[model samples]
Target: MEVNIEIPSHFLCPISLQLMRDPVTISTGITFDRDFIEKWLFSCNKTICPVTKQPLDDDLSFVITPNHTLRRLIQSWCTLHASYGVERIPTPTQPPTITHSNISKLISDASKSPQQLRYTCLQRIRSSIAPATTRYYSSRCKNIIVTCGGIQYVANVLIEKDATRREKEEAVFILAQMDGYDQEFKSVVLRNDDYADLFIDSLVGLLSSESSSNRERENAIKVMKMVYSVADPTRLGSVEHEMFAHIVRVLRDKVSKEATKNALKLVVELNPWGRNRVKAVGSGAVHVLVELLLDERLDRRISELALVVLDQLCGCAEGRADLVGHGAGLAVVSKKILRVSHVASDRAIRILSSISRYVGTAKVVGEMMEVGVVAKLCLVIQVDCSSKTKERAKEMLRLHSRVWKNSPCIPPHLISSYPTN
Candidate 1:
């Protein structure tokens, strides 16, 4: 029979409401479990003490201090109740101290040494350094790691043919986490053309690899987005067609909502560059986006992004043909006109305008009317939307008025608002 012993209320962490293991005292003199407090301050990005609600120091390293007295008390209590199904909490081992010099040397050795040494270094980083240190000193550690050429080292590990699966996953995690620190790290990659190509190629390989996990592919997509954000027009224009194909594949898979959005954003980023729009079209982006839009459960921002990409793709003849060719393309675009946000509505109108202005063959125009697009245009002119959106709608209506003005496809209610000119 297990004896029931109530844990002392005072011995519990204030945040987690459990007996404190590795108890630590904050600057506010409040005791909490180290893991809980670190998660609160670091992972949650909180700056106020949970108990006293006092402001914490900007330098978090000084804000948290280990409470040896409280820890021993809890340990003794656990020992006394060991026979009653309680286990004594062992003293916590100190995390290995990481300094800038330590990181710099580790990166240097990894970069210059043989593959064995490089693997060992990666192990040290993944096990001892990143997880142990990131919990308490994430911001400071990111700066140090980036300054010590950690990005390049990790990228090399990701692309290394002989790297273990675990090591490559760790590298992907590090690269994804290391972004958004500062532009200095990105600028380094951007300035070196050969390194940039290798890095991009590795990421594209991951996206295209069947063996790569969804998490890995998502991280790779994130890193690609960051890289392209800072890439010059020359570099963006020179992106390989295979990369566009893999990106379109990501969209079609709907890997994750965030990954999908990043994929869309990546296409938008590259669309304006030389031949990228054509590349995207050849990769079947238009068909994928139209399919994505047909799903009614999409997020508002996603709808906006899809519309935006479609609009950009339509700038090219190939993109326009793809949209007009899809069975639901015109219908989906017309359906979103007033059903989504103002931005979405505007982009939808722009797509219609593009189709009407360029590809408005008699058969296409007749199909547009049958699909309720001609009616949607009349509604846009009547509704309280942006002036620019209203103008585009009016322009499309006037351009097609000769054919649609007296057409019965438009409802009588919306006919009054149709552009007369």
Candidate 2:
């Protein structure tokens, strides 16, 4: 007869509910399997204890101590139950604990080492340390890494001509993960014109590189967005055309939703300075944004961002011409007026307002009338949209009343609310 052996509930991990292979106790005084807790804390980007529901420190120094006593008990239980087909649990080997001092040394050694060793060190920093430290404990680790000169080391790797492809990718990945958390660091980079230019040039090179992987491109764009957010006005005004081209390419390729959103945001950020609007128009941003909005399945946030970019771009003559020139541009912008969120509606109205106010030639006004944009504006006046939006709609109607008023395109119900001014 076979004997059934019941496992003790206390011997199980709180998270996995399996026999603990390598039990570890968290700061909350709760024991869980090491793998399970690490996954919760690092992989899931969480900082709370699963069982206790207490907030864990957002510090990399927060330690998960090994529960050797519980591990031994679980091992004994498995050993005693060997007859019931339970295999003896082997003792788990602890990984070397990573410390700030060791990380600093590693970065220092890599800084002075040959290319191969440098790559290896960067790989370790990216794969092992950077993700865990930067993802959750950004505020804490940002100061530490910045103090260790990690940022400069990584930037050097990116600008080094002899650096291998993997080395550059890893460097960008680490820099992207950092995400410009330290504003002081950003100020310092911006103050040094040469360093800032070289760093940005390397990131743009990644964006424009055909050999770059999708992940690499995504990270590079993220870093670029962060860098440009705090860039000085002079630096923003001088943004290279190639950078805009690559950003538009990222938008067209739709590398990922995050990448697309960041690219749109980058365009919006840069458009306010110098000839960036023209550069974006030259890079085909208007067409790409219009095409993106035409997709019915695009999420609300992306739609809003796309419209926002279009609104900024439409501030310039080149932008207005490009938007009106695209086949679906006016139609899509009109369609989003009251259909998406308030922000989207606001931006959409602003785009039309720009076209009507500055570029409202007879032909363009007719295009707006034919595309049902006139109807949408009429509807906007009667609807419960923002007062600002309603005013803009009325202004557009009043601007082109001679052509759009009493036009057959305006729905009869909406024509009554059309601005008579």
Candidate 3:
């Protein structure tokens, strides 16, 4: 026969037992609830323990589901419950209907899941909602995170947990993906210029990250370029110099031609020569740039990028001085004037004009001319090079070289008819 207790519904609330409300304990050892204590104390011989007079099992925890006969059996046992762990078999108790606060707390905790799976869930929710709907969610992210702390929880987990190096990199990429379009993203980008430097500094830190794959590093660098595009100097700062050098370093190491192309594009945007500024460290960057000029392994994309950077540097007085001090780059470029195809040769000649005439560079050109770079340049002008190329080369070689002294600054076409080199 089924025996049951008609325990009132209100008595089911563990908090409302006239015992404790909003009960909380950070400690793991806080033992039995008040109900259990009361039950065991009053159970007498009817149950092994007042709180828990049922037969004990080795299971450390229990879960209930509507389909389980055991859950029904446990409910029958609850009517005779005693608080202590050992108990005479007691009738099952009815499970209380869940309440709103409990539901809220459950959701909060679920939302705060620290696993990648949790973010997958959040991303799904975020994508399913309308733009306007997400506006509302935008405000709720903080409190919701606090309750269950999902994104925050994930952030903390990512920051604090021991993940594989590859995992950490994926985590960083995920962070970038998530934060890129946060509706509030522009306020910081637009609201204050000073923060742009901080943002770039942070991105630069990411570029140096070990274990980051080629694709990921390229994306990070692309982000820096894009950020500067919309950024007003008022908001993003005069970071052109720092940005340029870092671009060079990335350009130097980047395996993808596209990365090199993109870097070149950014340098060109800084117009006429972003390279010459002190912060760009004309003194430092020019040497590396020149070395690149000498490296034939560098493609036209890289060479064009270097030229654009040189042009930018020429615009700055300090940059000009820096190149002037590094005469070797121009000397090498001048030497190439003889061997390069028309495209690269003309480009080389133009870059020489771009950075030539600087005081320090003039001396290097002087030494190079003294070493016979001029005759090599003139002989090339005598070859199948374009008229425009020859004209520019003649003008440049004439202006920068001591060897070309008193030599006619004749255009290559005009000189072609009469040259006795």
**lDDT to native, each model:** 0.82, 0.80, 0.48
Please give, for residues 1-421, the per-residue lDDT of candidate 2 as tens digits: 1246677898889899887888888767888887787667653546577887776643222366778888788888777877778887778653424457756876776676644256645654664445544444544555566677777777788888898787798888887777656585485456589888888888888988888889999999988898888887888899988899999999999999889988888887898874988888898989999988999999899999999889989988899999888888898999998898889999999999999999999889999999999988888887788999999989999988999887999888887888777
Q: Write the per-residue lDDT of candidate 3 for residues 369-391, one digit (tens) a residue.
A: 55445555666667888888777
TM-score of candidate 1 relative to the true fold: 0.75
What is the TM-score (0 to 1) of candidate 2?
Answer: 0.76
lDDT leaderboard ranking: 1, 2, 3
Query: What's the CA RMSD for each of the models?
Result: 11.1, 10.3, 16.8
Q: Clashes in model 2: which pairs?
A: none
- The list of candidate 1 runs beyond 4 A from truth reads 1-98, 105-137
lDDT of 3 at 403: 40
Kindly report which residue stretches of model 3 are placed more than 4 angstroms away from their true locations once superposed.
Answer: 1-168, 171-198, 209-215, 235-237, 240-245, 252-260, 270-276, 335-347, 360-363, 370-391, 397-402, 405-421
TM-score of each prediction: 0.75, 0.76, 0.48
Candidate 2's C-alpha runs over 4 A off are 1-97, 128-143
Q: Is candidate 1 or candidate 3 better by TM-score?
A: 1
